[model samples]
Target: MSTTYKVPIGPVHVGLKEPVTAWLELDGERIVGARVRPGAIHRGIEFMARERNPIQVIYLSERICGICSFSHVLCFIRAIEDLAGMTVPVRGQYIRTLVLELERVHSHLLWAGVACYTIGFDSAFHLGMQLRERVMDILELLTGNRVNYGVATFGGVRWDVTPELAKAMREMIRYYRREFTPFRDIVMDDPIAHARMRGVGVLTGEEAVRYSATGPTARASGLRIDLRKSSPYEAYGDIPVEPIVPQDHFGAARGDVLDRFAVRVMEVYQSLDVLEKVLDGLPEGPYAAEANLNKVLASLKKAEGTGWGIIEAPRGDDTHVVHLKGGDENVYWWKVRAPTYANAVSWPLMFRGNELADAPLIINSIDPCISCMERMMVTDGRGDPRVVTRAELLERCRRKTFDMMGRRA
Candidate 1:
């Protein structure tokens, strides 16, 4: 006779850095079924955006996900620009592309490191983070901040990359190119990594499409859909981007963890090449228009249209929709759909029929960012359940912000 039981992984787990509650149906070491519960850390960003002006909303969007902060802000700005029928200068477009690709490099490197740590390779994880610092430093130099990178605004970027900064970025790219071989060898060629990752979380191309997966997750399954390639934005139209599929380096698509890893590493190279092209063809013009906030606010108040923005974030497509009220500076309504939300449905499919030990790696392979999910649950350790109101949560967040700022000062 066979016995089956349920195992709950987390709202918190040793293997996962973020809170994702996964319920697995296990028969001994193998998993027969799986269900993931997200929304443990929702921040209600879209609702809050209705209270802020367009300028404030840009910064608000960045708080959605730290790893892909630039992607969110860019999408929000694009939506605002489209609504107002504003034109960003050619130079501004190139600058946005530069920062966007730099963020991609940083995000992928971070994911690679996390993947190593999840599989119990500490040395490789440290090395990946050490290399990632270079990208962070470049981003800090360009945007004045490393993580949030508050660069994009309504019509154009708030800051411009100087010629010297551009030179430094080129040098950084060259250094990364030279160092990539060893990094690739460690992650791709290691026998242990191959044994652990290959064929572990296989999601077929059909499954990926059905789930509406985007970014590396979809491409790893041989789906040729990249917003940069299929739906060009920013400077991507000026410099074409070719979609990188898993089969290019892996020979054939298995749609497994290994294929996702290969696709991300391959994309680092592609992003580097695209960065170089943007730099070489960068035009000369004003980086940002005049900062007349009152005028901008007046225009926004009078504007009564809906705008949609979609961009390929490091993980996948990040979309934002904005509806401007006819007589208010604040937005009437706003909605955000992150890639993780789309991929969340596909987790059960990947987790089905996989070993319990492989669960963490498979979950992380999607680059799941639960922070972007608009849900939150507060758990009290006692036997009794407690009800927390939304006002209380918002106040708690505000207090934390003040405390953080006070500490910084």
Candidate 2:
């Protein structure tokens, strides 16, 4: 009989983008079992929401994930709108969709590059990064910020698609159409890439459903589920979107790392199509229902109820739940369930039978955002749960900082 050993692959591994631990039961180089431990990077974002009003929380929501910042903001705003009975203008809806697709393109390109880098395909990685800059440039031109764009507001978008901005968008669409295919082809056609990825982290369609996998993670497993396609919202209602599945492009959805990669690559093209449709169908009207912030806040003060917003974020479906108390200016409570929370559940399933070297690729196949998924929970040494007040948390942080400084000195 072979000896079995336990090895922890994270909390601070170079291969992982965020702080998450995977304790692997290894027999030689092959993984026999795995347990994922997250929460190393929890920031208590949901708890922070209680102190801020709806407007202040928008910026806080944006900070949840730099790549899909708008998704969080939109979801949070939609929840608030649901309670307030607010409706965004048609022009605003189209603009919101435009930004959403742009964000998707940005997110997919970044992930694709990182995926290449993870497998030591540095040439393709660099090219992918270079290609990504064009979309970021367009985003900056439109919103004045490349990452946490303060674009989406409660009722509608803060900025309109100016004629010049519209021209830039059209140019960007053409640029990606001409350039992106070759980059995708480079990796998809590479034999070494196939050797590294194909059949390496298999998660079946049935397994994905069982695990509640979302976004590309689920689609890669051949699940025909995309919120944009199934439950159309905003401009998606006007410009229909079909979920991209591996079986449709390839003969079969092997439900492995390669299939996940292919699904995201194909979805980039799908986003481009959506972007074009949004531009063509752009309407003329006010972007926000009420541009005045004070008035919006005042109206929200009288509303009291629980509201939920769910949207197809870059990685998967992003959900936000908010509760408001009547006559209260601050948000009573809030909860966020990011895609990584759902996709990470299947990590152990993917890890089974895979080699030690393939751990990073499989973890990354879901394009996880650890910061988005993390939630704070304090417990005593005896395992009894306890609530740490904000003051106590701050004191602990300061003490830790001082200790680190003294050690360095």
- TM per candidate comes to 0.91, 0.93
**CA error at residue 274 for candidate 2, angstroms:** 0.3
Which digits, one per residue and each the tens of the lDDT, describe model 2 over residues 100-185? 99999999999999999999999999999999999999999999999999998889999999989999999999999999999999
> For residues 323-381, what per-residue lDDT tens digits would candidate 1 score against the true structure?
78678889777778888888778889999889999999998999988888654345587
Poorest 10 consecutive residues by lDDT, candidate 1: 376-385
Scored against the true structure, residue 49 in model 2 reaches a CA lDDT of 85
Candidate achieving the largest TM-score: 2
Show where candidate 1 strays beyond 4 Å: 375-409
- Each candidate's number of clashing pairs is 2, 0
